[model samples]
Target: MDINRMQDKIIAEFENLATAVNKFSYFRHLKKISNGSQPMDPEDKNDRNLVTGCSRKVWVTAYKEDGRIFFKADSEHSITRGLVNLLLKVYSGHTVSTITNTDLYFLHEIKLFNYLSASWMRDFLSVIQRIKSLAIVQHLDAAPRS
Candidate 1:
């Protein structure tokens, strides 16, 4: 029921996961988003916006679009892309406040933290925080006066 449990279940599903399979999965997510879904935007059109925490070449972009926070991401590896999809499914479609305030401790409950080393964990957390901050700032900017 919690993010931790849910993450464990998800991990169990991927316990035998090969990195190559993850690569293919990212392509699947991209195709799915490209078909009709709105993927999160990368922060820049250039190489500057790319996320550095990932094992592969990854880019994550976030924008407060409509009433929802839309995230578009891409990775040079399939599994990493799948990871992005997993993050998107959990983090997207919520309002900025919702995303910012939610007990993301659920990720810990899901055991999503084990695979990474400390540095990677720090970067990953930084990425999540950045996305939340961008969404919150955008929302405040767009809010109408009472």
Candidate 2:
């Protein structure tokens, strides 16, 4: 996928998400959503509900229907939950190849990656690698299914 197109699409989609929360707004939302909510289930996984590595344990459940990927995810940390929502808002409904091969540089473009802690940076990269890895796996899975 083209970088410009990808970024443009992300921006558009995020803008449409009502509040379009950035880090601050996200934290605000997280604080509100942190009222002892249970984590989402990983047992009910479908084809796309997977994330490989993360500092805070996370479960991403995805379903690609009608050429749109719908994702439901949860995590232990408030910030992680927020991040999951952010990721789903963009990558949830896209095809494995559309997600994997794209130049979807999300961190900087999203304007939140810049404020990340050094430790969080490592976690962030790991999570991203996990997503890419899964996308690649699914792409291969879609190949012949032999």
Best by lDDT: 1
* CA lDDT of each prediction against the hidden true structure: 0.59, 0.58
Q: Lowest-lDDT window of 10 residues in candidate 2?
A: 30-39
Candidate 1 has an lDDT of 0.59
Q: Which tens-of-lDDT digit does each residue in 49-137 have in candidate 2?
A: 44554566666654456554445666667776665555554565577766666665654655566567776666666666666566566
Question: Which stretches of candidate 2 lie above 4 Å from their native place?
Answer: 1-26, 29-39, 42-53, 62-70
> Who wins the TM-score comparison?
2
Superposition TM-score, candidate 2 onto the true structure:
0.62
Candidate 1 structure quality by residue, lDDT tens digits, 1-146: 44345445545555445554554453454345334434444445346657655445667676676887767766655545555566665676678767787765545543456555576466566567656766787688788979
Mark the 10 consecutive residues where model 1 has the least summed lDDT: 29-38
Clash count per candidate: 12, 1
